[model samples]
Target chain A: MSHEELDQLRAKLDDKNMELLKLLNERGNLVKKIGEVKSKAGTKRFDPVRERKMLDLIAEENEGPFETTTLQHLFKQVFKASLELMGEDEQKTLLV
Target chain B: MSHEELDQLRAKLDDKNMELLKLLNERGNLVKKIGEVKSKAGTKRFDPVRERKMLDLIAEENEGPFETTTLQHLFKQVFKASLELMGEDEQKTLLV
Candidate 1:
């Protein structure tokens, strides 16, 4: 097995990681925007129905070496963090 | 405020999640391939130096509503999972 093959594969993995990074940050920005809208509308940030729907969609679309449940758990962690961020926004609004 | 705005943003968020799903599975596949090569070459699967470099790159690139530290933590969780997956491949080879 050529070291070159391993090196090339690592490069590709790095590229994928960067793509993931961009998407995650983009998603974060969207969540913040949504937070602003929700704050204005006086609507609560956590919508269980929508969260469940998103998780279901992920489970349906997953074709993976990682199990659907594992991915869901990881995604939920990010989603929960996003919720906290929204809460932060709410707190800031209250302060201001 | 039209509910339509919230719904549209939700749709975009879902799209971003799907993209993340695809990239993660793609990364998993690459890691598995790298595991095979490493197994054949008698090299260890986890390379801390490479891992550190990748994390550093991510920290550098993070421009976020999500802090760089938060992104790094989230990424490390996924990376650890990938490492476990590589271990699974190694085990299957030994079993075979």
Candidate 2:
């Protein structure tokens, strides 16, 4: 491919990457809000039933170019991490 | 209080703490299993609606000296960490 074409493709890739980052950041903020509510309510930090439900929801919701299974696995991890950022008690409980 | 009585109380406390640890570990193992299933299934993790449901369940079930809200917050944190141990993709997605 021509150098100009290559450069244009690279720019497009960069833009998509940025979009992903922005979406992730938005998710993080929402999760953080959850954590705050949880903490203030003096509640326990983990809920497995909910986590399982999430997977089911994604399976239901995905209109996939990617495999359904792939999306489920990927989002499972995403939700997990978002939980980490959101909950301090979870961090302590796991470590202990 | 006598020294011997104090020592006995200390041992009781230790025993209770150990029991709590054991229960937490058992929960951890179960969550890890959930993680594995989610990964294989290609599912998303984290369900706020489910989390709310859990708190409601706890409230309904508790015969409490401690408040229902307190238990909910604490368990929420626990579930979050279990997710971290289980899912790799989530870790990457969050960091980026």
Candidate 3:
């Protein structure tokens, strides 16, 4: 690819990154809301059953150069991060 | 909140998860394209300057219950996953 072509590709990648960031934050917001409900209901913070279902759904939707295993692992990290954010928000609420 | 209210929140979270999944796969596709360009041009796979700039940009855009530090850490994981996918794709090409 020419230099211009390469730069354009990088720009596209940057746009994708920003989109992912926004989506992740949206997910984080939902996680916080769920955390509040969980706290109120005395439910566990981590739900393995739901996590497994999520992984299954992601694998079904994956049409990728990325392997299913890789997608699973990446999404597990995303899930973990969201959970951490939820915990942090919960702590903050407790402190207030 | 009532059980119905909690269930509604969980359903919303499930929708967010699907949206994030689609965005992540889109990112993975872009990463593959960028990886191809990097391989052809003999450029480094990892770019720390770009990574740092990305972090800074994300922090600036962040209006969050999640802290800047949390966003940075989460994004780092996403970046790492993208790099891993790139590397995997490169290796597959080499093997072919």
The top-ranked prediction according to TM-score is: 1
lDDT of 2 at A15: 40
Report RMSD (Å) for each prediction in the order shown.
1.5, 20.5, 2.0
TM-score of chain B of each: 0.92, 0.76, 0.95
Q: Rank the candidates by DockQ, best first.
A: 1, 3, 2
Q: Model 3, range A1-96, lDDT digits (tens) per residue? A: 356777898788778777877777877788888888888888888999989998998888888766788778877877887788778877888899
Local accuracy of candidate 2 as per-residue lDDT tens digits, A15-52: 43333333444445545545555565665545677567
- Write the residue-wise lDDT of candidate 1 on A3-94 in tens digits: 99988998998899889888888999999999988878889899999899989998999999988887998898899889988888778878
Q: Residue A13 deviation, candidate 3, in Å?
A: 1.6
The model with the greater lDDT, 2 or 3, is 3
Ranking by lDDT: 1, 3, 2
Per-residue lDDT of B42 in model 2: 62
Pairs that collide, model 1: none
Candidate 1 vs candidate 2: the TM-score winner is 1
TM-score of each: 0.93, 0.43, 0.88
Which stretches of candidate 1 lie above 4 Å from their native place? none
Measured against the true two-chain complex, the DockQ scores of the candidates, in the order shown, are 0.78, 0.02, 0.63
Binned by DockQ into CAPRI classes (incorrect, acceptable, medium, high), candidate 2 is incorrect
Q: Give the range where candidate 3 chain B is weakest over 10 consecutive residues by summed lDDT.
A: B62-71
